[model samples]
Target: MTAAVLSVEKFTVSMPDATASTPALGLGQDIDNCVPFMTVSSDNEANEAQMVDVKKNGGTNKFDFTATALGARDLEVTVVEFDPAQVTIEEVSFTLGSGLTANVTVGTIVEANTFPIVYAHSAGDTTDGYDHVMMRATFTSTTNLQIIKQVHQADLVGHAYILEALNGQWSIETGASIPLAYTTAQTTKNAAITVTANRTGLWSYWDTSDIGDDPRDSIWDGVITDATNLDLTRANGSTPSADGDIESFVVNFAADVAVVQQGEFNYVTAATKTAAISAPGTLGNTMVVATNAYGWCESTGVTVARATCQGRMTFNSAIEVLGTRSGFGNGEYRQNFQVIEWLIGGAAAAAEPIIIMLGY
Candidate 1:
């Protein structure tokens, strides 16, 4: 069914009835004596379009009225008081209802609302100033009433912030804060929730969840951590329609884990110990008793092996080692020795697992 709501915007307009230093009631001096006609305008100059005065409620000193409203943004209201001889006026302040909310208030003046409806004002004197109870009407189409009502029901499902995982799974933390979810402020009619992660920009409607039905009906980001046991710091957003009102997002970074400890160490490998102990980084970096025992001493001495030599010796289990030890065989004792140390993920790839000893 086609339906709409009239958003009420009200303000009080008053001018000094009779001032001590002011002119007495002659032709058009005193307020009560003169026929005071008040009209709303959008500008302070009293030279533009006039406002439709909606005598909404039974408010005397106050000009109570409702204008079809739009999104919450900026609005200016001008109040014009006219008589044969105008009266000096000040600012115009307004109060909004329901979905209609205002930010700043300067006496009897403000910027345009979601829509611009300029009202003119005629001041008796520029220094004295002019005032009028002015506000614009902004008509906005709303979602279906059935769905809207269901949203505010006592049993209505609370808002949510989706914590998605890398695996395309998600977990829903309701009644909690969600980041980047709400593009608008929370209001009596609707509320917003944000879901944000550092480094990764905004994801799809897809989210990983472990609560309520699978949420399979809608698109979701995947792979979320278990509920009630994750980082559940939620942040609130402006009012967001549960319906399809997509808001853009900015790319921000969120930290998953901080560096706890960083360490570097040096060790020795097997093949080096037996061979003539070529160029090794440091002994004890990593020692192994391969075909021979006594890893440390027989341990490969200190030498920094190159990339190719490091790998072949570490994983190949055997490498040709030439030694001048005359104790076992002929003049030069050349034999196969296994690698004692592995250097992995070095400055570059192809490196074996290096000796990484942790420190306090």
Candidate 2:
């Protein structure tokens, strides 16, 4: 048994009024002012196309028509419906990145729901006196949209910007645009940072959450503190070229903990006095046994045990005779002996300073 099902498809067309013409086969026939008809075809021979009467739902628009019951074999539904005259255009205003504003409105019939189409506009006379700018409007929210002007510059052309829409919000995705002759822009600013010696050039951050898992899913520079924490900042200049897509991370010498404290001593691993030293108050009073505890040392860049170190240091045991706190060997010091870790014990004592003691 051939199962039968009914399907409906909607088409929007911008049709003009038909001209009055007589057919050769008919004699003295006045077939004038009749509505035009569209033929619907199907790929499967077994399934026949059904034509339905077009009705005007209280509107004078001629493009308003519906096709009903496009029949086909069970589970085999393939139909073709197209109208070339249905495209239209409207004007809209939007802002650009370089503090410029422009607009474009595209009117096209699409089979599926999508964001409103916008196009680039030519340079025009404005109060700012800007010219030859390519601009695009994107919906920032369901009710809000942005008009961004593309900036142009030398050697930084051909950078592609991808736009992705989600939940009615439009965002310009980040990534290296593929190579092309030149990039079109609406603003007159460099779109990318030029490469220089010992300096990294322009680059985009990859957002792994995009629809296609696109690496260059976002067009921003960001820092990742953890798996869930990401802070994105816009590029200072033009978007980077495709050559700058891959990631090259440089360990900041100032921020790198390892480099900053590479020469520091390990207080815990250093040998400590057999007995806990009492907190020190006076100088050269058989310095009280230091609380050789495992923790970070705040004394940074201090010369201890013939080594320079910075940042906190964890000690496996109490530091006794300056065995080694941060890469410093036993009995080495830049300052007087027993000055580092010299705890001034009192009821209202100040914060303990992570001091490195001079070796005897």
Candidate 3:
């Protein structure tokens, strides 16, 4: 023999029509529209009972129990996902009338209305030949309708809508079927990328000789091909043939580059070179350094100038200086170095002096 246990498969609600006559439940007309309740994460029920105890003067326990207050039952439902089209009339700003066909969009105002609710259960007791079971509650009111919005995480649970039922007057019906039709949940995929026109000459850079000269004379125009790659060519769209011309350039993205997936390797390489260059100067001055260039203090008693090496700068007063290096394909590379400050006893010098050295 099969077990008689059953699971709640569907839950629905029917709004009351003011023009129609009340049913046997003494609430409203039995339209039986039975719209399927939207997606729900959890459904919980609570019951409270009120009673009075009677006892004799010499008795050790209560002799009798009596009902003193009205009983209360509540049903709480929470939905993490739902179908907007099916529930637009019921949940959004709309009103339902006699049948499901009479729904009207009433702007933003939602009326406080009472309705009937039903909970349909799965097939139970095959030997007894019962198809399914359903519980119908009349004169049910919705309370504590809360809308919760939170940060999205791994669960993919977006907005949550909670509904509470008060004044539970209900009955169970055997061998019942769901009346209304419901739409299956649809899968929404990510949008496709659209590129209408190609963007060229997005960026340009000048060489050492062209620093104060005409930019068009030595400018290397950069063209972006896609989201990850860029091409550098002469302003005239020709490859470099002579020396001192922009040879090849490459960009190596770090492991944690923004918008790119982690652990994925991405890089762009251009040409070849024989030697790298480095020039040191004070702050606010552009200084180009080759990859892996190191700066250090050589001697004391000399005012050390603040030099912008690559894209980094040295400390104001320190025995050793370490900075970031550019010109490499890699972006924003850093090498850590210990800094030691010198403190001499005796009278202090008018200006702290230190020698700066650059090495490959």
Candidate 4:
């Protein structure tokens, strides 16, 4: 007698949510959470000795059985969950035709591939049944495997079925044995400008250093420079005091990012001040009032440097006039304004600081 070789595919025997009634092997089936039994049969007399068993390997389960038959004949596999108290049962069956006559090839070799992630069929939280049961098994050749996840359970209906993958950072399944993986990465760079002034001075409006008769009033052109004996006064007609505190004003700033998106908090609230940003600069244009607002929300808790990086706020106007004319998504884009002015309720408040943020 010629023996047939067979290696069943991997599958998970999903247990329903119910009480275990029948004792040994849980195969007695008391209804609800009863164990399932499987049987293998074929037309050929040589196939009568075939034994089918489901084995648990880690998170996966496999069906094991004889692969080769004496001459050639069709084989039938049946699985059923029974309730010992009742005769009715939920059963399913499949037919595997003779290896010599069918296109499928049977083998005795142990063929199995493990996935990077472990898949769990049941949540095990409630006695409630599942929407469906998904199983992966190889019934054809050793190399060809088929996954079944859409099988509907008799008790579970209307609800959706899910296969939870717990192992990798990210999982992408295409109904295949192996799934794709994904990870996240990030980088940062500083863009704050620093400088010192030779004399105490007041900051004039954005573009021009001297807007009024007071040449002593000056605003840095959003440029960074360093030197000794720096004068940092910003109120017009203010005496040139040796206040080194003024020089320390524009020193610290956060690193600039390639992109900024809306954060979780809203821009404007009763307790917080709103901030604004402008587009980057182009060849002929500077950040001006006409620049677009690319942000979806307003700025809150904005500081002087952050508000400055965003753009200049008018004396009392709610809008922030960005210094750059260029827009976001440009080949190389950045915040347009290098310098900023602070004001409260339409009046300049050189003393009060603001907070700014660039969301990820």
lDDT, model 2, position 232: 30
Per-residue error (Å), model 1, residue 5:
46
* Candidate 3: tens digits of C-alpha lDDT, residues 115-191: 21112111111111100110111111132211111111111111111111111111111111111111112111111
Q: Which stretches of candidate 3 lie over 4 Å from their true place?
A: 1-212, 227-230, 236-243, 247-249, 260-360
Give the winner by lDDT: 2 or 3. 2
lDDT of 2 by residue, 73-179 (tens): 11101111111122111223332333443333333322111223222212222111112122233433333434443332111111111222122111111222211
**TM per candidate:** 0.13, 0.17, 0.13, 0.14
Number of colliding residue pairs in each model = 81, 34, 3, 25
Pitting candidate 1 against candidate 3, the one with the higher lDDT is: 1
**Model 4 root mean square deviation, Cα atoms:** 33.5
Name the lDDT value of residue 237 in candidate 2: 31
- Compared with the true structure, all predictions reach lDDT values of 0.18, 0.21, 0.18, 0.19
Model 3's number of clashes is 3
- The residue-level lDDT of candidate 1 at 47 comes to 12
Best by TM-score, which number?
A: 2
Q: Can you give the lDDT of residue 294 in candidate 1?
A: 7
Q: Which stretches in model 1 have alpha-carbon errors above 4 Å?
A: 1-150, 155-199, 203-214, 222-243, 252-360
12, model 2: CA deviation in Å?
Answer: 21
